[model samples]
Target chain A: MNISDFQTRFGFEAMYDGYVDAEVLGGYTSDLLSDVMSKAGEASTLVTIQAHKNTVAVATLVGINSIIICNSRPVSAEMIESAKAEGIALFRTDKTQFEVSGLLYCALRDAKA
Target chain B: MDIPINTEGGSRVILELIYSLKVRDVMTRKLVTASADTGMREVQQLMRDNGITGIPIVERTRLLGIVSIGDLLKALDQGQMAEPAASHMSASVVTLEEEMPLTFAISYLNRYEFRRFPVLDKTGSLAGIITASDIIKTLLVEMNREVERLEATIAHPQTIDPAASPGLDPGSAGTPEEIVLSLSFPTRQYDFDGAGKASAEFKKALKQLGIEASIVRRAAIASYELELNQVIHSTGGVMEYILRGGRITIVARDQGPGIADVQAALTEGFSTANNWIRSLGFGAGLGLPNAKRSGDDFSIDSAPGRGTTVCVTLNYAAGP
Candidate 1:
């Protein structure tokens, strides 16, 4: 599934739309940046409540292509600017990280099938 | 030429060399001294014969003062060439200790206007003299030796057939060609704004080198964790990335205060960060472990009063 599909299918609002719309290989749900840095796979979507600039920095370093700030966690302007600069798709959802991760996993698995 | 002993941006090997080498190691031990009452004309003759710009005026190995070519010129202009060297020599000279680190000599050279400093031994007797040119010459020789040692350590690429490694991309299967890339980034303590920039750059460079994605990912993870560790805990530090001979080595060095306990610090979930830092999605105590797990070889050295140094080496080929 492409990064833009999250906004269209899950009704998540797009915070930054200047991304490459690359295919999302999978998803990692973590609020800890170290955990995300150590375990997050490349080209994955990050589902977390970390709505700050550092989160985008970690996403860029680890090759995470998309980020979904769950629970409507008030993403900062700097976060939006960083996401745009790094070409990472930024989305915000009213659902929790658990819900977003489940939905993303099923979607990615079904796409593989 | 100003020798920039840039601790924050210079190569670690050069920095270590300057810190490890003593002033006596590079100073010229051959003494060409004259008595305090020696005639200025004789001093001038000594300077000309030895091709030296300055000569230390001594009394039986006890340094009293130094007379430069400028002083001789002044004496000759004043028709006082026959005067004693003591009359024209500059006293109150700034001197360096023989046991002092080369870095001190470098700073002394920059701090003072003197072309050279007379090195004093433990008994306060003049032992040798050091100049900026001497430091530069020694550094060039040492750096050449270090480069040769590094080249000697370059391992031959493995001959694993691409077919044997399932799912290996043919484009990245062959041994990576010899390429040298060296980068340094200065990281400040609690500088959340600049954190991870080094690792991001490393990732980009590896991708451009056409390294396999998995290897690049591992290198990126190790670098990121190490960089973040410096930002969160150290006063300030530098991150160095060197890619050569199909291996990537990331070295992070910081200024004090260092870790108190190495074993405890490496344990999972052991963190010294306060509540505020923990709130920033860091300080979970996985930084070192994560770095170690991602790298093919890892070593960390830290002490309470001194700074910390972490080195992680990643190979291009996947480990067995």
Candidate 2:
């Protein structure tokens, strides 16, 4: 899945312009950045309430090409810069974290099944 | 002034005007002036002769008031042309400093609805008068210079940065000369928000260095795990990514409230992570085992209270 597909499925504002073409593998939800770093390794798209710069860092470190930030959290300018630098695609949504995580999990499961 | 610059070139010009252009550079030096005792009709005649809309009413060097076309029209309609120019002019005037940025003048003009503002020097003497037109014309000149510079650069491209080094040339493979890239990053405590940034940057640098894809992936995962461990488990640390022709090495040295049992920490499903960490989809006790999985060699050294250090190394063949 591409970032635009996620944008179409759930209304998400694409933060970094260049990385919008990043691929989505599956989804992992986390608020603590290290948690995602340890568990979300390669290909899994991350969903979280954390919209800070380090979230982008964790996603990039774990080899995740894209991330979805829930709860309408404001993406700071520094976060955008870091995401662009790390080449990690960033998405923001107004929906709560649990809702997005569940929906993404079901969607990924269905895709896998 | 809300000058709607639609073109890309125009936007560049506006940016230059904001940063480098000053009010004195754009203001009209040949200013039309009036005295307080001058008749409103005479002031209007002076404005008509000069084909200008505003004039500063001054006594010697001190600015007394400013008469605008709007004020003159009001006076003419009220049959007050015979009255003194100061009587018809606005005494509360907004002024700009000659040395101030043109952008500031534009914003000031925008803040209060005014046709023009008086430009003053450091000594509080009137230097000139500036309007929106004057500012735009100056911006156009600056834009032209920028366009010329860009054209020159495009015509003759130059390599500007000194530190950029390209990776291995693809033509040869059997060369024995070794190339190594070294990098270091400092990690902070509980900076859960910033946990793995260093690993991410290291991964990118590895990719740029044209390291083997499998090795880069392994190094990234290992470094990330170690970095997160530092943030969650250790107090703080320094992470170093060392890339040689045949291997990738990650050394993590951290200050800590050290672990009591190294074997338990490395075991699968044994964790010291709190509930908060678990709720965020981690603390599954997988970091250590996973870190070990990603590299061919992993070693850990720790005591209960002092500190801990972990080093992971993956040996790879660097072939063109």
The candidate that achieves the highest TM-score relative to the unseen native structure: 1
Indicate the docking level reached by candidate 1: medium
DockQ of 2: 0.33
Error of 2 at B273 (Å): 4.2
Best by DockQ: 1
Candidate 2 docking band = acceptable
Report the alpha-carbon TM-score of model 2 versus the true structure.
Answer: 0.51
Please identify model 1 stretches exceeding 4 Å from their true place: B1-179, B317-320
Reference-based lDDT, each prediction: 0.85, 0.77
Residue A64 of model 2, lDDT score = 82
Residue B248, model 1: lDDT of: 88
Per candidate, native contacts kept equal 0.86, 0.59
Per-residue lDDT of B33-117 in model 2, one digit per residue for the tens? Answer: 9999999999989999999999899988789889999999999999999999978899999988786656657666666799688
lDDT of 1 by residue, A6-89 (tens): 988999999966668889998899999999988788899999998888899889878899999999889888789989998999
